[model samples]
Target: MKKIITLFAVVVGLFAFSSCTTTDDNFQEDFDTYPYAFEIKNVDLGRVADNEYNLRSTFQFEINDNLRDDETVLIYRLTSTINSNTPVWQLIPRTIYFNNGDLVDYFFDFSKVDFFITARANFNLLNRREYIDDQTFRIVLIPSDLAATMDTNNYLEVMNTLKLSENQVKKVKL
Candidate 1:
């Protein structure tokens, strides 16, 4: 009985000790920091045949399937650039008001497989070539956790926070 008890105690001790040792390599951090960005240049808005007041454009770009519910999509319009390197990006759902009291809004929506850019105005956009043609936009995808901590309105800040450089951004053909 004494020998049996000793063997049982040794087995239990061995099991407990083995279970206490955890390998870091076996564990993965829940935080996902990988971010990506893409640009659409000179994309002409097409009039929705059914709705004259709406000008829309669609692009097919695959987003990470796992991040479909866990990510934030931010869209910006390339308003200007200094020295041909530093781009000034304006965040949308932006509203542009003309002197004549016509207002046009730029906004976007996205799914896991594609995204749509839409221009909606109080008046028909067919006559306003400037608002419908040759528009440039940038789409940035980041984790929801990072998006909450960053200043999304400031394009430069967001870029810096994401550790993204101009060369890193790829231009997508539309």
Candidate 2:
């Protein structure tokens, strides 16, 4: 009876350890880093106070969410097909680092957008009754680890065509 009981205990311990061991199948899921995320707080466009020379409106992007890792944030100005008559807002690279603390603020000066688009928009507003071209933009947070290995060209090529995960897509409209 003693021998049988000792053997049973040993068998149970072995099974427990084996179940917890890291294996190839579960390695990725267990050890992969969590994706970075950003919750855009205030998405508003208005004039900057105390700056008379700056006639163009200021677009303020306030992100109040905490991130797990430093990420390269991609901001894109959607094409006309996606958001009709909207000006191409931006095409630039901005990185959000962990050291930025609980909140990060990024600003885009609308004054830099193409003159033609702004001119046409202003003209339409004056000529056509309450004609304002509503625009939408997209922000994608790419984790540094995945971004380092990503095929950027391919990703940009299929940006609109492919279905991106909800966790990665953030939208701001004007």
Candidate 3:
């Protein structure tokens, strides 16, 4: 009885380990076997105050091919919200090209006079496949009427309090 139980346990362990293994055979049918991924990092926003702000974001992406066959473009938009539950207003739309190397810097300005700001990056690969990689940051711009009451620390505090919602991670491929 002991021998039988030991053999059964061994068999189960082997089966479990085998089941955990993955291979290309289990890959999705539409999976693009690209050997690289676009990585976005070091996203920073600086407050210029007086209804003006400076935006700077940097990213490094791997390029598997140099023939320009694989095109990776970054699409970004600025969003603001008066209330958390309502729709975010899209303030600006910009596109950056990435086809030559592994790094790209995206910079722009926001003078819409809004208190809240969020940026979303939509990466389009090969002009067909799409992935959503977004980052959100807070911008504290002093209202023209209240410039006298503005404190630089207030902007820093707002930035530190900014959080990325789960909706930001949800990818919508086009």
The lDDT leader among the candidates is: 1
Q: Write the per-residue lDDT of candidate 2 for residues 1-174, one digit (tens) a residue.
A: 999999999999999766643343222221123222222323332323211111132233333232333545454433244355333334322222234232212333222221111112212122322112233345444544555555543435324322244455443233
Candidate 1: count of backbone clashes, pairs at least 3 residues apart or interchain: 0
Inter-residue clash pairs, candidate 2: none
Query: Residue 77 in candidate 2 has what lDDT?
Result: 39
Q: lDDT score of model 3?
A: 0.32
For candidate 1, the C-alpha RMSD (Å) to the true structure equals 10.0
Greater-lDDT candidate between 2 and 3? 2
TM-scores for all candidates: the values are 0.71, 0.33, 0.23
Query: Where in model 3 is the C-alpha error above 4 Å?
Result: 1-44, 47-52, 60-74, 82-91, 94-174
Q: Could you arrange the candidates by lDDT from highest to lowest?
A: 1, 2, 3
- State each model's CA lDDT, in order: 0.72, 0.35, 0.32
Q: What is the lDDT of residue 139 in candidate 2?
A: 43
Q: lDDT tens digits, residues 92-127, model 1?
A: 989988899988888877777667777888886777
- How much lDDT does candidate 1 score? 0.72
Better of 1 and 2 by lDDT: 1
